[model samples]
Target: MKTLIILLFFSIISIASAHAQSNTPAKAEQEIIKLSKTKWDWMADKNVDSLSTLFDEKAVFVHMGGSWGKEREIAVIKSGSIHYKKADIHSVSVNIIGNTAILLNNITLLAVVGGNEVSNPFIVTEVYVKQGKGWKMGSLSFTKINQPAQ
Candidate 1:
């Protein structure tokens, strides 16, 4: 009877452990998606303080016009060199691989650049890495899509 009880307890523990492990990726995905949306909001509002925390010091941002590091990206946003007026997200998906999370967002971005407003459809790839207790954006790239926004 003691052996049976021990086995039963071990079985319960194994099942619980498996369940928790399965949910971890889902939780991370949700977090990544939430952070990505918050980034868009911050960019539109020109909230560099908030963005500074979210972006890693060595982060890279690739825009249509040019690619730059975190400091340059923040400076441009603050100076309104490329104002991100709005981001109309069509679809978003996340994939977590080990300690890195990759997020792809299909969006139509309305922006003012060089005193002219333009709208463009792009598939934005955001890469995040686990840093201490939280995740920080390591890289962001915008790929202009030839197809229209759905």
Candidate 2:
């Protein structure tokens, strides 16, 4: 009877551990989604200081008109050259592979570039890498979608 009880207890612990492991990925996915939205908000607000911490030093950004590294991206944001007025996020999804997370956000972005207001639909891909206790954005690319925003 004691042996049976011990086995049962062990089985319960194993099941609990497995459940916890399963939830971990979901939690991470949610975290990545939240971070991605926050990034859009920061960009719209031109909060370069906050964005600087979230962006990795070796990060790259690809816009429709150009591609650049972290320093140039930060400079552009600071200068309000291409002001991110708003990001209407329609949908977001996240995929986790090892220590890297890929987030895709379908959005309608309103921007003021060259003193002209423009809106575009895009699929924004954001790549984040786990760095110690936090995650840093390593790459961000916007691919313009032919269809209109839903």
Candidate 3:
């Protein structure tokens, strides 16, 4: 019985993964894209409460200057240390792998850091994991782009 149960679970996982890899962007892909866009708005507004709910407990955030976990990220936003003024997204793409989603956004971000306003192009990568009925952000990483935004 135990062996059979394990095999069944693996089969389910295999089916889920295969389904997620389909070329057509399905509802799940749309959902992830929308979630990522909303996340930008939350950051711009400094809505730590909403962001806190979206981010997983073990979420990791990576920036040009440093990298930190969820708690520190919330603290930083709440303290107004790095104010996300706006994000002008050029393009966005998402790939769902089983219960995990990887989203990429090419954007030009306007932010106030250390009381100085700056704008920079970045390729932001967001990883989300579906837990229960909702998705939680597991990682957010920003990679600066030297070229102009397309």
Candidate 4:
């Protein structure tokens, strides 16, 4: 009888663990969403310190003009070469697979590039990799939308 009770207790714990694991994706989605929004804020403010920490050392950034790595991206922001004035996000979606999160943002971005202000609609893809207890952005690619209307 005591052995049966022990077995039942372990079974209960096992089921509980499985249930918790099932809910992990939803929680991870929210975390990624919040982190992405915060990243936008950092970009708009040109807060390179926060952005540098959030971005992976080998992170890649793709823009309409060209693509570059993390250091160049940070330098551009610091120099006001590409000032991310604002990002009007229309929609966002996140997918989590293992230790990777891919986020898509539909936004109308207003920015200053080479001292010229421009607003463009873009679908931005951001890939983040979970490292230990922290998440770092691995890639940011922007695809321009042809249609003007949001």
Candidate 5:
């Protein structure tokens, strides 16, 4: 009777552990979404210090015009080159692979550069990795959307 009871207890524990493991993807997705919004807010306010905190130490950013490391990206933000008049993001999808996550999103960027206004639709992919206590973006890439040919 005692052996049967022990077996049942172990079985229950195993099932609970499996259920917890299955929720990992959903939890990771939520974390990424929250991180993305926070970073966007920081960008909207032009707070380079706050924005830099979202990126990992070895993060890489591949922008439409250029590519940069974490330090270089922060430097440009500090230089006040990339200013957002109205930046909106939507259609965010998150996928997880082991400890890495990929977040794909569409963005509408409205800005003024050298007195010329520019508004464009762009697709962005941000890679995040779970490091230490929280998740930090490890890489970011953006591409412009071209209109269909008539």
Candidate 6:
């Protein structure tokens, strides 16, 4: 009877541990999606303050036409050279690797650059690291989708 009780207790502990581990990735992914949407909203409105909160201290951004470190990216947002009129994220995929997450998504940005109108479609990949209390964007790389404009 003692052995049976001990076995059942161990089984329950194992089951609980497994369930907790399984939910962690899902929770992390959801947080990442939320972050992405927040970024899009901030960009659409040229909200520098909001965008600043999403980036890590050491984030790196490889934009379609250029690359920028965290400081420069923040400066760009502050400068407000290009206003994001609309941003559409078509699909998103998330992969958890240890304490890091990789997010892939297809995006469309409608904006004007130097008074020239443009609609940019891009394939974006971002790596996020779980910080002490939340996830911070570590790196972001994007490539322009090369199809003739309709």
Highest TM-score against the true fold, candidate: 1
- For model 3, the superposed segments whose C-alpha errors exceed 4 Å read 1-25
lDDT of 3 by residue, 101-150 (tens): 99999999999998999999999999999999999999999999999676
Which runs of model 4 end up more than 4 angstroms from their true locations? none
Question: Per-residue alpha-carbon lDDT of model 2 for 4-71, expressed as tens digits?
Answer: 99999999999999999999989999999999988889999999999999999999999999999999
Model 1 stretches with alpha carbons more than 4 Å out: none
Worst 10 residues of 1 by lDDT: 141-150
Backbone collision tally, model 1: 0
lDDT of each: 0.95, 0.95, 0.94, 0.95, 0.81, 0.81
**TM-scores for every predicted model:** 0.97, 0.95, 0.84, 0.94, 0.88, 0.89
lDDT tens digits, residues 1-150, model 5?
Answer: 999999999999999999998987898899898888777777667788776777888999997778989998887666657665665786799999988999887888776654577887878788999888788889988787884111
The stretch of ten residues in a row with the least summed lDDT in candidate 3 is 17-26
Please give, for residues 70-109, the per-residue lDDT of candidate 6 as tens digits: 8887777666656667778888989999889999878787
The reply for model 6, stretches above 4 Å from the true place, is 148-150
- Stretches > 4 Å off in candidate 5: 147-150
Q: Between prediction 1 and prediction 4, which has the larger TM-score?
A: 1
Local distance difference test, candidate 1: 0.95
Candidate 5, overall lDDT?
A: 0.81
TM-score, cand. 5 vs. native: 0.88
Clashing pairs in 4: none
Clashing pairs in 6: none
RMSD vs true structure, all candidates: 0.8, 1.0, 7.1, 1.3, 2.7, 2.2
